[model samples]
Target: MISRSSQTAAIAFAVLILLLSASIGNAYEDVGVSISIKGTRSYKLKKEAQLLAKKQAIISYLKRVNPSAVGKSCAKQLVNDRAALIKRITTQEISQVGDYMEGSYLVRIDDEKLNYMLEELGCGAQNGATDVTILIMEEPPTKANISMILNPEDSTGVRKLRGLGPFAVFYTSYQRSIRDTIISKANKEGLKLTRLDTFDEFQKMRMSNDDPLVGVYFDDESEDFVINKRLLKVVRTRFAAQNTIVLYYRIESLYFDQVTRELNAAIAISLYDLNSGETKSVGSQDFMVIVPKGQSSVAIRDGLAEVASNAASLLMNQAKKQIRRMASIAQVHAQKKGTLPVTVTVHLKSKRTMYNVKKNLKPSMIRHSEIKGDSLILKLTKGIQADDFVYGELLGVLEGMGIKIPENNINLNGQEVIIQQ
Candidate 1:
């Protein structure tokens, strides 16, 4: 009985020893030790690490590898075991590493990178982790104001501009706040802007001349556009001739006064410059004023104003003629230089019509005159030729009233005549 008891106790002791050994082995295998990286959590790893330091650290660790202890190779084992915990982040997100503890330093991954690594490790998950914050720049609104003013030579005439002048001219002023901004933006975008104001300035400069020139000008004040000087030069150029049409008139059946030795009646004279085609009053008094049909002093003023007015018309005609002469010379000179001058002519035959016989005929009945060099050649009022002379008297009366025939150009073939110029 004592031997059996001793055997049973020895067996129980062996079993207990085996069980304790198994428990100790399992405990050693189940140990949960953590490994960590000591560098930046928020900082970019590659940029922060110097190649030299990185290489040295890796070389040192390689040197410290204990060959006797491994199952997997050190490099392979580290990669496979800890790749889930190795966080990757962009350079901008990183700040710095945290406190060191025991023999390992805490790996301070960027909050963003930390979440990323946790997700990859199958430990924690997050949707967005790499977004960045930034500020936006904007531009201010533009502001501009424009104003106008008008200045007139004579207030009364200015008020009557709508009735007389072709048009009125006005000036303008501009105020812009965002001009610089617009310029800068234009430069950045590679664009060009025309300086409209420079043209306005140029027009103002041109208008400063005393002589009249044809051009467009601006003045903000009046807010009206105008033609500064009469455009007679162009008209004369188109007409090609300046005509000096002379009119001579004599007062008939006048009774003469003996006392004071003056005539009771007077004559007036005026001329129109055909080139300009305007009727300017020329007053020439060749008569006398008398008291109750007798000579008086009142006629002197009338004579003076009349004579001056007639002389003024003649002077204008003479000026136009001179201008035409110069233009003709220029044309000849240009032709010599191989530039051809254009000439236009027109001829029309007059036909008898019942309307022409009317006693009262308007000026519109006359056809437009031909431009001959610098003169306007108006057809003279004369007789007309009818297709059939059945109503010969009516035709003659009409011719006497409204027909304009060129006298110098008339040709005769036995009373059946042809007009020629």
Candidate 2:
């Protein structure tokens, strides 16, 4: 039995303990932090520095809160616990305010979120697993955009009909050889070539036609083929080349000299940077072949082959040079733009189909990916943008690899692309 005063004192003591316990539990509930990343001249490198600063901020905060729990080996240990760390360190918002000085970037980090992450990693609490956050640091590969232009008149005209086409056998043979050689050379160099057949196709489809070099015309017709440079400029503006290379080639002239009994061919070649609209003639070659007075099928075939071989050799050499130039351009562009983010969503029709999709995805292209039930979300390397062309290209690639992508099931909204089986 206690007195009234004693009972009141006992109740007060219990209340005091409850308050202390609550305060202890909520000690690190909300914290605030500001981190400044070192200056970098390159915008691409700036992102990398910022990511490092964020990681250091977390380590520093943990050390300040509980040195004993985090220990001296914390940084090394956190590396192994990245996945767990990312799950716990969540923020309502993260803002990049501005540059601190020179090229340094200033960022605001959520203190509360940082503290919570530390707690989860056994910084000041027990019964928790250690956590670590991972930041993607590597830049993605850049894609080269190449456009091939051919002179419309190159394939025109009537001459010694050796082949099935209306054109002279030599003319037809030379055209086929040049086209095939350029395409083959481009393919060997791992270039993605875009071939536009006609100026009308270029206009109607809204294809890129910036530099005048992109309009190559073989002067085969007796009438001169006039070009509208202004229309080309308009087309370029609407379809900005950005990081693209345009290639142009034309058969300047071709004729048969009956007195000399020789077939003469003149070709001109040029390369253009669509991004800058600058043009340079890589090289030009003039070929001549002696033909017999009486033309036999064998004689015609042999003459045509000789002309084609010489022309192809010259064309191929220029193509190789252009390929090297494109590689250099791609390297510089990648440094400037970093990597383009692409989100791909794959809708599954069946469990087997889901497995197939996962398996078929290129490992090199995938930066990060996750599957939510029947749908797979992938962050793939950027080469193809979210456009009708890309969608069609993707369909073709997948189909080629034995994946059936229904035509009506594909959708692309900006970078959020979806493909249903």
Candidate 3:
């Protein structure tokens, strides 16, 4: 019995020793293995790993070391030297995971080790166990998952702003700039930013349903600010209309020809709405032109060239009627007290000795013609000389009209004349 008891005690002691050894080995113990990156792109590993570390809440230690002359020579000995080191290192790391150790772990990582390892494996370890805390984080969320919405109250002044004629472009560009500025400010103000792939989706979101959190998105500092569709639509419609007007009416060149009668040479005529998409017609009459022929090319080009000036006077007389009809149809009011211009003013003169004198005078010399009343009017043109001949004709016309022609009353070469009484 004593021999058997001694044998049992020895076995028990051996078992305890084994357990104690195992526990001691495990206490304050860690296993770490070095990674040898391969290839020239190894420099990229540190950056990628750093990013991965931050994302995964892991700490990475990078040590700087100059290339060893001997190691460098050995590595340069063959094309696959770097590859061999990478294989060795990887294999060691993998096989050593379950290794039993009694001291703190260490992973000697340098730029060179990274290069050698990477040359063997094009990509770094994707998912695996490392002796150290090596964490590779998952990618961040994409912009497509987020939503945007425009607000309605924000859309009020947009249309009117877009109506400022040529200034509309500046406004549009300014709006984009302002939005970007707001986003940048938001970023500086500590707001998160995200980018959406398409702006069309942004334009479609409703007011209350979309997210209102503003963010920086895409490559630019655009307000990934969410807004309601109604608001966006208001701004979009006005801007679109303004752009349409600009594009449709943007004429690269314009030319005009005038049709005129001798009596109406001095009148100014032009096409008012030339090259506009709304007025597709090529005739000046389409644009309501009523100037004398050849007065301005704008009239014909603007589709208003066809309106006759002679007949325009008649139209002017009935202006109130036309405007009233237009106003009623257009649902807009016409301001009262608008007066139409008189196109023609007629004058009558008595045919007598005075009329002959005035009529016979050269165009260079001013002359007056007698009217039914004892009055005279001067007829004038270019190149008229102020002289006695012009005055004599005027004096005769005044006397013939039964007005006393004072010597002072007849001014030579006068553009206008008055009969003396």
Candidate 4:
């Protein structure tokens, strides 16, 4: 019988090997495919078998790494490509039997160029992971947590924040856990995924001078925190809908059965459609699960991971129709937003102008933006006719942002608009 220590070591070794194998598969690594062909022993037959074997090897690699994108075009071009994918092709000892050729060939390849080509075709692991962002905000389960929400009597934000410590550290660690767990779950579900870090940028915009969200912080278990959360959800969902991204969000409130004192995690999901900027159903299923202790951040995270996993399941399965709709909208939005970019130059003299300029523009139109010295440079999205970019469109948005471009200072150079302060 195997000893417990020995079994533990063996299991650890097995896990290490599996991890190593997965890591290697992500990079340029040798992929081997075996082929068996029977025919008259001829050079043409040898060439044919080798080519098929190389294509098969590439297909095998794609199937292993990016199964979802392994379409007909993935290996279609390789059929006519002469050779060079072969690291080596070995033949069995029994190369020929009587008048017919019957043997096996093993093809091995580690072609970096082929890897680049596959990436271009979106048939490799490098381009496979879908970009995703998720937010999980937690609150303590107590009368205060319940009473502050929608309580018209408590007008000031002061009541909820009384004597409570800064939630930064807890929020950071918990967000990290939520991100890692959900992204891992997404990858296992064949939704290879990565997180798009945008919430901080959005928050920065919200706190800019003249912004309504100035001085508003989150996770305070307050009445307005729910409203503040909508901004977060909006940014995440809008970005998700605009880009090929997955955004999972949850507002977790720790609650108790008033009678039994049973701790539970209450999770709420957003049904807001970021693509069309509307509510899809004003509904996503809310979840409540009895979990371990939740008073401390550590305990809440450990318990929350399980409930978050269930929420992830709901997002990818039951709520997937929403995701699919967003994707379809994204495709149409992509086509509409095309590659024709018009430059909109803003004087970056004020921090307010810098943040709000990007914030106010139609997300679909803001392509590339940067601050060059004192100027906030924006290369707006291309696709729309340059003539269609009327000052009416530009001025209205600028007015919304409290930016006034004087006639003398505003110059239109074809598709480019230069506004100098």
Report lDDT (CA) for all predictions.
0.27, 0.44, 0.26, 0.46
lDDT of 3 by residue, 1-421 (tens): 4466556654553454344323321111112433333323333654443333222111121111111111233233322332322221111221112332111223222323433332243211210110001110011112232211112432355533221222221222222332333233223322212322123434444222232212211111232222233433332322221111110101111112222211111111111111122322111111122223222222222221112122222222222122212222211111120121111111223446545655655555432233333333444443443344334444455456565644653322112222323
Better of 1 and 3 by TM-score: 1
Candidate 2 lDDT, tens digit per residue, 314-380? Answer: 5545554454344344434443444466667666556665566567656766677766555666776
Sorted on lDDT, best first, the list reads 4, 2, 1, 3
Measured by TM-score, how close is model 1 to the native structure? Answer: 0.17
Q: Write the per-residue lDDT of candidate 4 for residues 189-302, one digit (tens) a residue.
A: 234343333334344545223233311234434423333455555444234322433253454443334234233443443434433555443133333443222233333334
RMSD of 3: 40.5
TM-score of each: 0.17, 0.35, 0.14, 0.38
By summed lDDT, the worst window of 10 consecutive residues in model 4 runs over 132-141
The model with the greater TM-score, 1 or 2, is 2
Kindly indicate the candidate among 1 and 4 with the higher lDDT: 4
Candidate 2 least-lDDT 10 residues: 134-143
Candidate closest to the true structure, highest TM-score = 4
Q: Which ten contiguous residues of candidate 1 have the minimum total lDDT?
A: 132-141
Instruction: Give the runs in model 1 whose Cα sits over 4 Å from its true position.
Output: 1-244, 248-255, 258-261, 286-341, 350-421
Clashes of each: 39, 2, 37, 1
Candidate 4 C-alpha error for residue 351, in Å: 12
